[model samples]
Target: MTKSATKIYILDTNILLHEPFAFLNFEEHDVFIPMTVLEELDAIKDRKKDVSRDARIAIRALEDALVDATPEQIAEGVDMSQYTADHGSTGKLAIYPDHLLNQKNLTLPGPENDNRIINAALHLQREKKPREVVLVTKDINMRLKAKGAGMNKVEDYRTDQLISDIKYLSTGYVEIDGSFWDKVTNCESKTEGRDAVHSVERSLFTQPVFINQYIFDSSHSFAGKVVAHDESKVELADIGYERLMGREAWGISPKNIHQAMALDALLDTSIDLVLLTGPAGSGKTLLALAAALEMIVEKGIYEKIIVTRNTPEIAESIGFLPGTEEEKMAPWLGAINDSLDFLHKHDECRDSSMKYIMEKANIQFKSVNFMRGRSIQNSIVILDECQNMTSSQLKTIITRAGEGTKLICCGNLAQIDSNYLSPLTSGLTYIVERFKDFEGSATIHIAGVMRSKLASFAEKNL
Candidate 1:
C-alpha cells in the first residue's frame, strides 16, 4: 500500500486491551482498526478484569453507535473498512482469503495471528490511497511486521508514561518562627533551616510540578521528595554477636557482607523508613525482622515491632474471622510467626529461646485498617504486601509514624494485587517516587530471586 495524503491510523488488538479509551486520545485522524481487533475484543467480553472487560464494552458501544448508520455514515464516524473481509489490492497490496474473516480467526494467536490485520490495512491502503498507513501497536513484533510490509509508519501504543530520570534534593528543616520559638521553651526536638530543604524535596516528588519544571519522557515519568534528615550523630540498637552469626539462621546468615550492609542501613537511627521491592522470596521480610529483633532483644531501643499488611481478599472482613481479637489475628500473624520460628531455631543451640525474647511481649501485629486514628511511637513497623496500597493509603500510613519509630514497607511490584494499580500506581511507587531524595529514607530493589527455579521462571516469563 502506498502512503496517502490523509493520516490513516491502523489500530492493533493489544492497543485496545491496554487502553480502551484510546479512540478518545486520537484527534482528527482517520482511525482504522482491523476486524481482527474487534474479534479479539469480543472474545474477552466475559473477563472480569477491568482492562479485558472494558475493551469489550468499548467495542460494543462503538458498534451500537454505528448500528443505525449506513455503511458510508458508519465509515465517517468510525472506520469500518477493516471489518470487511474483502479489502482490495492494487500496487503494493495483496488480498486475504474470505474464510480468514470467519469466527475461527477470532481467538488470540501468536505473531502469525497479526498477519490478517496487516493484510486488511494493506487492502484499505490500496483502495483508499490514504496519505499515510500508520500501524499503531503495543506488540513489538507487530510493529516490525508493519515496517517490513512497507507501511508508511509504525508507532508503539503507549498508554502510560515511563519514568526514566530521577532527581534528588536537600532535607527539610525544623524552622520555627521567632514568636513560636519563644513560646516553646521546651525546644527539645526543634531545629533550624529545615523548611527550605523540605520545600525543595517536596517539589521534586509529586509529578504534576516536575512535568513543567523539567523535561522528561512522557512515557515514563518518576520523581521523589525528601522527608527527613539527620545532622547529629545517630546511634543504632545492637543485636548480640551470637544471634547474628552462623549459616543455618533465618535463610541468610547475618555474617554475609550484603546482610551486614542491610543491617547497617536498618540500624541507622537517622533513617525512619526503609522501602524494599523485589521478586518473590528475596528474604525482605526476614531481613527486616532480624534487624528489629536485634534492636528489641539486644538494645531495647523501642517498645515493640509492629507487623501489618493490607487485608487479603480471600479472608472475610475483620468481623467474619472467628475467636477473640488475638485468635482472629493468628491467621494473619502466621507468616510473622514462621519468620520468628526460623530465627529461634537458628539460635536453639545457643540456649536463646524466642519465647524468652518475646516474653516481654514486644512483638505486635495489626492491619492497615486498624492503623487509622492512631499515632505509633517507639516501634519498628513492618508493612508487608504494600503493593496493594494506593497513593492515598500510603500517605496515611507514613503520616501516622510518631517519634522514635521506624517503618519498613516491602512488596513485589510485579505481582501487585490491586486491580487499579500497576507498578507505577502502587503505594510502593508513591513512597519511592516521593522519598528518593530524603536523607532519612533509602530503597534497595532486590533483583536476584532466592525462590526455587520454577518460581523464578514464572516471575520472569509469566
Candidate 2:
C-alpha cells in the first residue's frame, strides 16, 4: 500500500475568523479560497464590534500577502506576511497553501451564486480528480451539503479545540504509589514545577479515585515526567479566617493543587490583580470571594471587599436607578450574596463576622458605573461578569485600584451576555491579553464544573 497524494482543501470565510491559522492546521496540501470568501470579509470590514472587526483585519492581512503574487507562487500558496517581532524584525509567517496550485484542477464558481463556495469545491473536485477534495467548514448545513453531494471527504475545522486530544487534555491528574502518597501527606511540595498538580486536585475533589499508585500529569505535555511525592511536603490547610479588630479572612479552603495555585495567585502580594476565566460553574466568583475573605479577615491586608459587575443597560449611567447608590446596588449585589451564602455554610461566625468585616473594610456593592468616582484603597475588589464589559469599562475598573488594593476579575468568556462581545474581543480577553506579560498580573482558567452534572452537560452539549 502507498500513501495517496495530498488532498485539495477548500475553506469557507468563517474558517479564517474562527481560526486564523486554519490553513496551517492541515498537512502540506493544495488549499483553495473561493472569491466569495473575500467578498464576505470585505462587507464586515467596518464592524465596530471587536471580534468581527478583528476578523476583517485578519482577512485584509491575508489579502495583502497574496496580492499580485506570480501564478506559480499563487499555485504554491504563499503565507501571509510575517508579523513583526518585539525586536522589530519581520519574522516570516507560514501561510497555508504553501505549495503552488496546479491550475488544471482549479474551479471558479459564478460570482452571484450564494452557494458558490460549495459549488466551487465540487467543481474543483470533479476537475482535479485528486486523491480527494475535502470541504472544511464550521457550518453544519454546509457540511451536510458536501456529504449530500457525495463528497465523503469533509471535516469540521478543529482549530478551536487547540488541544490535540480532548480526553488527555482534561484537568491534569496525577497518581502515585501509597509510599509516595505518604510523602505527599507529609510535606508542602511544588510537584517539581508542575502545573498538572492543579488538574489532579480537581479530579480528587469531585471524583472518586484510588489513592494508590497511578499515572500523574506532572506538566502540560506528554513529555512531562512523573515524580514521586513526599507527604511531609504536601501542606493541606483550611483558608477561611475570622475578622479580628478590622482584619481580613479567607472564604474557601484549598484542598487540591488547582485551588492551591488559585489561592497563591490570588494572595500573591506582588500581584496587584488576578483574572479567572472559564465556562460557567467553574467556581470563579467563589474563589475570588474566598481569597478576599482571607485577605480582609485573616490577614487584614485590606479594609473591605468591594464587589461589582456590569449590569445590562445599566453601565452607561446609574442616575436613573430607583434608589440611593446602596439601594441601587442591591440588584447587582445578589451575586455577592450568593457567594456569601456558600461561605457561611463552611465557616463558624461566618455570617456576623462577614457583615462586620464588610462594614469594617468599607466593603460595598456598586454597579460598574458607580465605580467611576471612587478610588479603591486597601481593598480586595472583585469584578464579576467581566465578559459583559467593554475595553473602556475594563480600563476604568483596572485604574481604580489604589494603594494596598487588589482586584480579581471573573467571568465566562464562552457565555458573553453583551451583544458587542465575542470570545476574543470581550473585556476579559482584552484584560488578559494586555496584562499577560505583566508580573503584577496573573490569569488562571478553572477547568472543573462544580455546579452539577446537569448544568455541566448543558454547558458542554446544549
Candidate 3:
C-alpha cells in the first residue's frame, strides 16, 4: 500500500485485449507496458478480427495516460492519478524501453513478442530487487516461461475473474433432500393471485440462494424461485412441480426437473436475460430454440428471432467461402438447425415444418462480429457458444439489446474452445455470477443429457 512496498506490474498484449481497462485495476502499483507490447498492439489494431477493436481501445487508453507527459517523463513514468476516477490510484505509468536493454541482460532467447515481454519483466525484476515485479498475462504458457526465466511474480490477470474454482459456480438452482417443506417447517405461507408464496427463515438453508434461483425437492414434488429476500427471511414463489413440467414450448415438454426449471425460465415474459450453461447434450440449445419459436411464432411476444455467436478460428476463413453473413454462419450455427429439426421431426413433413417455422418466426442468423453499432429491438436473440467469449465481448452483444428485446445466452463451460478462457474465467460464468441477483435475469444449468445414450456416455466418461 505504501510507495516503497508498491509493486511494478507489467501488462501483456493479451491482458489488454481481454480487458482494455486492465491497467487501472492494479491500484497504487507502478504499471509498465513493454515497448514490445505497444508494437504488438499496433500490429493488431489494423486487423479485421474482433480483437482489433480492443487493440484500438487499449491504445487510446494508453495515449490518454501519457497525454501531457514528455518523452523523458514517459520513459521514467507518468503519474497515473489523473487517469483513474476512484482517486485511489497513486502509482505511475511508464513505457519500459525493453529493446534498449543490453544483449547480456536477455534471459529468454527469441525475437517473439511473448519472449520479449517476458525478458522485459525479467530485467525489471532484477532492477527492482526486493520490490515485486509482476508479469501479468492471460496466456498460461507465457506465465510459465516468465517464471522459468527467473521472474519472481507471474500471474494471470484476474481482475475480471469472479470465481477461482469452476466447481463453485452456481447451477442456478438447489435441490433439497426429500421434501422442501419437511426441512423448513416454519414457513409463512400466503397466496398471491393463483400462485402460492412462502417466506421462511434464511438460516434454514445450508447454501445461499439468489433472486430467481430455483429450489426444489429431490422427489420433484415441489419447486420455486427466490422471488424476494430480506436480512432474515427468504421469499419463494412456490410454483407447483406438476405445472412446471406441464409447461410446453412449441410442442417440446420438459424431460426432467432440471429441464423443467429451464423451460420455466425461458417461457417467463418478465425475465429479459436468460443464461443456460450445462454439459454437452444437456438441452441448452434445444430448449432455447423451442422457447424462441413458441414466443415468436405462436405467442407473438416478439417480432423476430436473431441467433448469433462467436465462430472459432476456422470460421475466420468464412469470407473466402462466400455467401451472405447468414450463409457463412450456417456451419457454426448447426446446433440451432439441429434443434429445429428435432422439434419438428414427428411432423407430417419435417423439412417443410422447419421452413414454415423459420419464416414464421422471422429467424435470422447474424455473426456476432457484425452486430456492433446495431440496436436490436422487439426480438429474441440467442447467443450460443458464449463460454468461449471474454466478458467484454459478451458485453458488446448484451449492450446491443434495445427496448422489448430478450437475450438468451447458451453454452457449456466444460466445452470452452478459447485458449484464453476456462470455465471459471469464461464470460458465461462471469455473467451468471454477476446477474444472479438481478430481478429480470434467470440462469439455469440444465442437469443431465436428453440427446441420446451415446452422447450422455461421452459427456460423463470423456
Number of the predicted model whose TM-score against the real structure is largest: 3
Q: After superposition, how far is residue 265 of candidate 1 from its true place, in Å?
A: 1.5
Among these predictions, the greatest lDDT belongs to 3
**Could you tell me how far off, in angstroms, the CA of residue 317 lies in candidate 1 after the best superposition?**
2.1
lDDT of each: 0.58, 0.60, 0.89
> Which should have the higher lDDT, number 1 or number 3?
3
Q: lDDT of candidate 3? A: 0.89
Rank by lDDT, highest first: 3, 2, 1
lDDT: worst 10-residue window of model 3: 81-90
Model 3: residue 370 alpha-carbon error in angstroms: 1.5
Q: Which model is ahead, 1 or 3, in terms of TM-score?
A: 3
Q: Give lDDT for model 1.
A: 0.58
Query: Candidate 2, residues 209-265: lDDT per residue as tens digits?
Result: 211112322331121111222322222221111111112225355533454445566
- lDDT of model 2, residue 127: 63
Model 3 RMSD in angstroms: 1.5
- Which regions of candidate 3 are displaced past 4 Å? 84-88
TM-score of each: 0.48, 0.52, 0.97
